[model samples]
Target: MNRRYVVHVDIDAFFASVEVLLDPSLKGKPVIVGGLPHERGVASTCSYEARKYGVRSGMPLRKCFQLCPRGTFVRGNYRVYEAFSEKFFRVLHSYTPDVEEASLDEAYLDLTRCRPLYPSFTAAARDMKCRVEKEMGITVSVGAAPNKIMAKLATRMAKPAGFFEVPAGGEENFLRGLDISDLPGIGPKAQVVLRMLNVQRIGDLWGLPRPTLRSLFGMGGEEIYLQSRGIDARPIVTRSKPKSVSRETTFLQDLWDERLLLAHLAYLCDRLTLALREDHLYAHVIEVKARYSDFRTEIKRRLVVMPLQEMGKIYKIAEELFRELFASSRLALRLVGVKAAELVKSRPLALFEPYSERQERLGQALDRVRGKYGFGSILTVRERMLDSVYDFEPRRGFILKTASLTK
Candidate 1:
């Protein structure tokens, strides 16, 4: 039988490194990507030079500025980042079919079946990492071990352009002396609790009874207990579609006007369906959210018998939900939102299906135009009211953050 081997690859400071690669002038400088320091947003990633000033991903740009005032800040271009991610994944897929995309910058590969072709697991991982760096002009850290947990941790151990491998029987030795804080699931709170218990190292956690660990961390404790001993049975999950996609915005002022609210709903639904169709996914569950002026929030959701990808169908259902929710109390709203969930791939059409073929074609047409001209180039007559509300820019869409997790 072949031995199990999982290789984890992580791009080092992916966004920051890409910025440096795009413009060599950024090299050796403290680069922070995500937003300008004067802007209202968080840092997506930063160069190691920025890290010296305590900068980090998800830290507010204002606070990041306070830490590294001289840092070069960039309002990152996600489309470029995504293009690089596509090339990065292609390199991983060249190695094995079983590649799990952990995020845009990281992936896990099951290379056990292909072991016979390589001199050693480490050699195969190193070659793959080197190819990514050479092709993408980005540094990558790699890890190889018998299980997923150890493999990922090994990558963290060998970060900033390095490689580490744990042979089949060496998981315990590889994990033993690592700091508890270095473990993925052990957050700051866990570290405090563990420090109080004198469990400062991965090896220290291994000696504690499983039940004690379980009592400390609840259901996740079992995972922590197993991970401490370099045991992880989680399979490589490679699903590219997310479980849900949503778009929402808070009004600058409370709104009692129903027509304007519907306009907002239509806009949000349009954005949501565009994301769904891009991924070749459909959703059977539709949800609508509304927050009244007094801080009361409400939502209405339904599960359909059949799934759909067309925006009109989704908006019709969403409109129904919003009307019902709005009529329930007829109060002014501070925010409105829409969500599509229970995602699945679109099924092949059967002969003379009962679905709306025209709506489907319309959505396809809209998607094609949006692909070239931009999403806001054309909007439904209903949603056009937004032009009067905000400083509308068809190509760039206004300054509203839809809280859109497009992926």
Candidate 2:
């Protein structure tokens, strides 16, 4: 059997790096993205300089501010970062067709088949890394190993524009002495148990049999057993189509106003439909969720005869679902959400008069505009009310999250 060669590539501080590219003056400074320090939101990303001060992504904006008072906080433009992500993926595709995108800033590439095209895996990985930086103006850290687990671990070892490799026979040596947390799925709770078991490092677990580990951790035990031995049989493949897509948010306060809730629902539906069209799929089922101020949750779902792709059609069904949930309860609402499910790749074409061709054309045009300008570029009148309620960016729309800040 041919030994598998997997390489993991990750952009260093993706959001902060993109911000520096946008404003060269911000380079070398501690730049934080998400919202301003005084704002009530989590830090999306921060530069290494900010990291040194203990400012990390997902940390509260207030805490981040306390850590790096000199840092520049930005209400980041995701549309801009998304644009760069396209270029980043394009670079990977040029190297190999077998690529798995883990996120906007990270991917795994299978280079075993492409070995004949270059002198070695290392050379191809180097060329791919250089091309990504050259095309996107951002540095990426990479790691290569005989399998995916070791490759991911190696990449963790190589950060902020660095590369490391674990040769075919060296996986065991590479994983030795690493912290137990370095292993995937090892959490604080698991650490307590592992510590009691006297397995402090990856190498320490080498003594335990697979059956023993399985009994200790259930179904995931096999994964832990194999990963600790530097073996990961997972293949690098393109992502499968999602079973469903959803977008929702918790209100800043319990809302009793139906108009305000519907307005926010329209915004969420727009975002959800944008995602549906991006994947070239349509939903046969539409679902809406509402969480009342009393913490009771209600949901309503409808299956349409004709699957939906256009925002107008999807929003229509979603509106009905929301109304159903709203009318069923008299309590104030704390959260609202929309979900699209039972997806199919082929969007149903509107061939009859009831579904006008003009409406189809208009939906296409609107999607094109949003694709180029961003989701916030075109908002319904109802969605416009969100402009005054939340911090609005012309093309990026409102920053939706669990907590909201009064505009």
Candidate 3:
């Protein structure tokens, strides 16, 4: 009876670390990668050095400036980050074909089937960490355990550049003393509810009766109960494709201006279409969403007769949806989002007969240039409207890390 083993690998301060690796002069210093500290954005990643000053990812750039005034801030380059991410995943694939990417900077590899290839799972994990650091010039932490829950938790425990493992039978002992908040599913709201019940630790949750937990949290309580006891039966899915790809931004201040909203929508559509083309996917459905200053939200969607991948087509639909959805209230909005769904791997040429092949060719050409230079190297006039408000280079999504930029 061989035990299953899952390995979770996370790049240390990925965006920030990449910055330091590119420029050794920035190494050992506080690096912030999202944007300038005063910009209307948040930290994407920060070096461990900056963490000492309470600077963290998702913290407002203004607040991060007040916390770590001396920190070096840089607008991150996503293409460079994407390159590094590809290298990182390539290394994982060398060890196991059953690797699951959790994000651009983290992944889970099922080592149960590969145990015979390596002397031990611990050795395999250590070798991976070493190779990543040696080859990529960036450090990573790895966690190995019987399940994904414990594996990810193990990775978190081994931060900076370290490795940790929990033997098959030691799961309960390993999880017992940890805080309830340490579990992946425990959000702030869950924590508030648990704290009210005097449940401060994972061990505490383990001792509660199932009915009591269910009565308090419904189906979520059952999940809390299972996870608290280190019971995750989910398998490593190596081939799961994303259901959708979307991007959204929250304004530093709410705005009623229509032009600015359209500009932002166009930019977001460009980003979404770029990603769709990169993955060789197309969307049959497009959605536009907006959140008002009062927190009221609205969404409008359209189903296209043919799946679309061109940015111009996607943006045009998004613009229509936005106008139609907001035509009545046109409330001042604090946030706006665009999403492409009902994705398909490929579309037939006949389906695109009504659309412009020239535009599609143009999109492919633009992607090639951007792939070589970087995202937003050539911006559309609509996207350029963001220039007045954004000082950092534009990309598909929000900026959240602070690092030194190259070129």
Candidate 4:
């Protein structure tokens, strides 16, 4: 049987490391990248020193400062990070054409075909890590295994700047001693539930019957059981486009009035529609997501046979869905979101019949103006209402405007 080899590469403390590279003085000090403490923002990433001080990613800025008063805090620069990621991927491409980017800071490379190119998997991993650190001024950790699951687990075991290899046929042994949380798909809730079922380790899960596990956690339990034994059949797909475009907001204080909620939904639909138009795409499905004070969440979706491009049309559908889903509920809302799915490339000019050439021209003109001046250059009345309600401001960046049309 032919063996499959997978390699996982993850940059160490990506944002914090970039900060260190820019300023030599911050090398050994505790560094934090997040928003201002007064703003309700959370830490994006922090240095190992900051972790020692009990500061972690996703912690509120105020708590981070309370834990480490002297920690250096810097606002995250996403553009710089994006540039670094591009350069890093270039180096990865040099090693294998079968590289799959897991995220901005992590990637997986299939080395089954190129195993003979290097003396061994360990050597290949070492060389890759060295090239990234030397060329990009960033450290990376690598993990090698016969499958993606084992490769991911190996990477976690070799954290804080190191490399590890799980030898062929040794995956189960490698995972046997690890905590249940070490499994990729197991979250805190799953861990608690598993503990209640008297399963404390990854090995313990292997003994449970698949049906019993499925009964407890549904389809996800079956997935976890397979993963526990390093049996992930998911391939690294090259092109994975998003099924939907969405925007969401969580209120610091919950709102109770139905009118106010409807207004917010209108604002979200406007934003989502603008994004859809910018992408040169239209959606046939509109989904509205709402979270109540009791932590219960609901999503209601409606499908249209014809793709919708107008903000008014999309918002009307979303409002109707929301009203139908929450008509009797009087609970305060914690969060609200709007999503557009079932997308297709916009056909401004059609062959089957004559369409509204004037509407298409207007959309193109508005998109050009927004592209040049920024998203705030063009806004509907609903977005203006959002500004009044939330004091929102648009940032300067590549808004998905006319750019998509050219592509």
Estimated TM-score per prediction? Answer: 0.60, 0.62, 0.63, 0.63
Can you write out model 3's per-residue Cα lDDT over 255-339, one digit (the tens) per residue? 7889878988987888888889889888766899998887867787764435678887788778877887677665898889999
Q: Which stretch of 10 consecutive residues in model 1 shows the poorest summed lDDT?
A: 398-407
**Candidate no. 2 TM-score:** 0.62
Please list the residue runs of candidate 1 whose C-alpha ends up more than 4 Å from where it truly belongs after superposition: 240-407
Which lDDT tens digits does candidate 2 get at residues 173-277?
A: 888899888986464556889999989999998898978986886434654776677765555646665668999887778998888888888888888877876
Candidate 1 steric clashes? 0
On a 0 to 1 TM-score scale, where does candidate 4 land against the true structure?
Answer: 0.63
RMSD of each: 13.3, 14.4, 14.4, 12.6
lDDT for each residue of candidate 1 in 1-407, tens digit (9 for 90 to 100): 45689999999999999999999998999999999888986898999999999999989999999999999999989999999999999989998887888789999999887866877777788899889999999899999998777888889889789999998889889888999877765756678999999999999998889789869975346547756777554445556646678998788788999998998888888888888878988775689999999887888885443466778778887887898889876789999999987677764244213567677778889988877887788889988876666554555554445433222
RMSD of 2: 14.4
After TM-score superposition, the amount by which residue 294's alpha carbon in candidate 3 deviates from its true location, in angstroms, is 12
Winner on lDDT (2 vs 4): 2
Q: What C-alpha lDDT do the candidate models reach, one value each?
A: 0.82, 0.81, 0.81, 0.77
Mark the 10 consecutive residues where model 4 has the least summed lDDT: 398-407
In model 4, state the lDDT of residue 294: 81
- State residue 144's C-alpha deviation in candidate 2, in Å: 0.8
List candidate 2 segments past 4 Å from native.
Answer: 239-407
